[model samples]
Target chain A: MREEKPGPLWLRLYALTVYLFLYTPIVVLVLFSFNDSRRNSSWEGFTTRWYVTLWHNELLMRALLNSLKVACLATFLSTVLGTMAALALSRYPFRGREAVGALAYLPMMVPEIVMGIALLTFFIKVGIQLSIVTVILAHVAFSVGYVTVTVRTRLAGMKGNLEEAAADLGATPWQTFWLVTFPRILPGIMSGALLAFTLSFDDFVITFFTAGIGATTLPLKIYSMLKFGVTPEVNAISTIMLGFTIGLLALWSRLESDPKSLGR
Target chain B: MKRFLAWALVLPFVLYNLTFVIFPLFTVLYQSMFTIDAEYNVSQQASLDNFKAAFSAANLEVMWRSARYALTTTAACLLLGYPLAYFIAVYGGRLRSQLLILVVLPFWTSYLIRTFAWTTLLQKEGVINAVLLKLHLISQPLQMLNTDFSVILGLTYGFLPFATLPIYVSLENQDRSLVEAAADLGATPVQAFWKVVFPLSLPGVISASLITFVPAMGDFVSAEILGSPETQMIGNLIQQQFLALFNWPMGSALSLVLMLLMVTSMALYMGLAGERDA
Candidate 1:
């Protein structure tokens, strides 16, 4: 490896500036979430009143519940389907495999608005009611591709020798899978499930189209609240969400960096 | 039995995608062939009218605006993201992953909240204007929000990570000895970058542009929250048709056109990139 050299000072400054630009808005929002003043125009004394108010807000609480429900169901469905697809594609040679792979990955390429409207039309045509169920279906449709890709990356990195060794040691196929393969791929499955949950939890556009009356998710609620006007409540809720998402990401990165700590 | 198990594992995924993804896309195509009436009734006879209406002068203007805004956003992201990715890739010796995590941390949050944060900053009575007023930069608050600038800024900000990650991947994969070889041959640092480093990183640039431009083209949320009626994009137009006007046929037509545009651009860009490789 070449000797390490610090980059030019200007490059470092430029990078710092870019980081500031990326972070300033979020920082400002978090700070104002604690402002005692109702108006976001000026800073006042700090208070957690908005956060307290958030818990009492029935609509916001319901939206949060709906978001969790949709995210959980969608994550479960997509994780199962995506893991199966990933495992099959990686380990099995089959006809139409490439075609199936392309079709499975197509959702990641399509625009959100197109998918939203198309699903809207499809549901109406099929006479399915637009509700939290529709939202979960839409979420799963888009997120399965992400789960598949994530798990497939982990699979690609893993060695197949362990499974072969288990089989050679007089283990049944199912036993080999449970004893060797499942433990090895568990991190991949967890990370993929985490990704699916995030995608479902954070989705806005597709949910906007599919969610009928009384099925508002957090993003939809946030969008309407923003349109209704700025309030410290939005800020407080956003900060909480930011914390949740970052915590998940930190967990994901830990799992990614030290997969062996999963006690395999 | 092994083949059966493999097919069984794959079948459910394939079937689900067929139901949710392929069928919906076909529905969009089918719906686009007809027209909607004043009472929001779909016409029995399919015609080319919706497609024609989609290409009308006013609609064409929205399409043009979408392309212009998306292109501008892509260019801005490239300009901002390339240098940062370069810095992290080339100079981030020990802290590469940490720096990259910082870059991705913002992206991992909700996009709507991030865009909403801008409203707090760019509103007339907001933080940015307040800062400017205190500094005596202007006599009154500038009309910053609900304009093309705000919309594009939001787009660029939201997609910067998308641009940076790809370019960083491309840059990080480069062979360091090639740069040393270029220097050994009396090439200046600038020459080495332009001839060796930049050329090799074109794949990342191409992918970055593809990912950025395509999503920006279809994005309505940024334009919806940050822009005015005058600054509406194709995405907003589609949203209006579907949600507000109940014009599903027209919305479907517009969506098909948008998809066609994305596919065409992706094909043309890949072809160009391929030629560069050749």
Candidate 2:
């Protein structure tokens, strides 16, 4: 690992070209966000009109709000349930534990289209009205898988000494958990929540099926716009979304780099 | 008290899974056996009629077409992704994380947005043809949109990152000393790569292919948005049946078959991968 043998220069250049090809479409999307033309053929003059249009569109605003609501709710609920599941699975020696773990992670592997259709069918049969609540519930069902994977790693890596020490010093289980265990794994929990939020926010297929009328999400709205054809407003939204995700990744990297911040 | 609390903590997940995931999946099989009407009433009669309809001559043709498209798209992803992933994993150090983030940022955005971006690039008056015309590369705009080629291109582009990351991880974890030793034993660089690198990274390739294949099999968005009727995949057909025709039974049957195909392929992939590892 310590050896720093430099490879051929052409090897590095070829790698850079590969990266460029992979990312050029997204770069083009971001650049075209500022194009003033209605058609996406040639870039005219730069303008912020599309951004303003996206901001002022009431339907888009509603969809954005719905997406935010579902993502936030799903993140919170999945984080709580997932962390508890992670803790239990990591600590307990129980029957059917592997099966439970497999069941928990199965949602991530199943195709979203199939899950969406299945849940939609289930909701119909069960007489549950499809709404934003249904969307949130569906999101939680999948988000928990991600949260479990993330939080379980942290919990598994965590030694039991701190919580045991707190209990040894006459702390209650609840107090020990809140003070000693929770703080140690908070970064993992937060990171998992952020990932859940982004996943739920960007989800389209499942949300498309489960969402009732008036429960449109940002993705559904963007999908509808695609059906109509490409618009500069779509580019603007993509650019903003791209910027937002990059910013979140940057912030997450910062938080992760601070080793002392995650004491566990 | 501790046992009770543990049970309480586990109950929510258990209940959610049973109600949502397991029940719904089994119900899909159940639903396919019954007759469902427009009024959402289900008849108790069991029959293979829906399966018959789904596997009818025409629909089977659609399934075959979808499979062919999925295979091509998966092949494209591997073709484009392997060399790129190999280059990045071997040569990229400081730039790897940044480049990876760039690859994944589109993933973080809506699938609709990325497909739409492709549309903007592929439409008749779109940037791609415009640039081609401007540069005099062709006398006329390429008739590229709404074809199998467009769907394949979109699916490949969308799934490239999914294929790249696993292979990259596997390659990054490869033992450098093994490669060095092989080279020192008079093996050429290409020989070392084929003997040492390819064999070690086969697991990632298998898993990557599975990940790419399953989703591409069920990916309705890319085909619906980017493809014409001739190129619509099984996903689009399933969606049309359930959403538009309100034919839950046939849709459920179709969905079941698709799921079975995915599971079977994935199982085979993992089986082969494990055998190779052993």
Q: Which stretches of candidate 1 lie over 4 Å from their true place?
A: B275-278
The C-alpha lDDT values of all candidates are 0.92, 0.82
Model 2 per-residue lDDT tens digits across residues A86-174: 78777775666788788778997888888998999899988999999999999998888888888788788778888889999999998
Binned by DockQ into CAPRI classes (incorrect, acceptable, medium, high), candidate 1 is high
Q: Which stretches of candidate 2 lie over 4 Å from their true place?
A: A1-10, A257-259, A262-264, B36-42, B271-278
Which pairs clash inside model 1? Answer: none
| Highest DockQ model number | 1
- Candidate 2 colliding pairs: none
Q: Highest lDDT: which candidate? A: 1
- TM per candidate comes to 0.98, 0.95
Could you report the Cα RMSD, in angstroms, for every candidate shown? 1.3, 2.1
Candidate 1 residue lDDT tens string, A209-257: 9998889999999989987788999999999988888888888889888
lDDT of 2 at A18: 60
Q: How accurate is candidate 2 locally (lDDT)?
A: 0.82
Interface RMSD of 2: 1.9
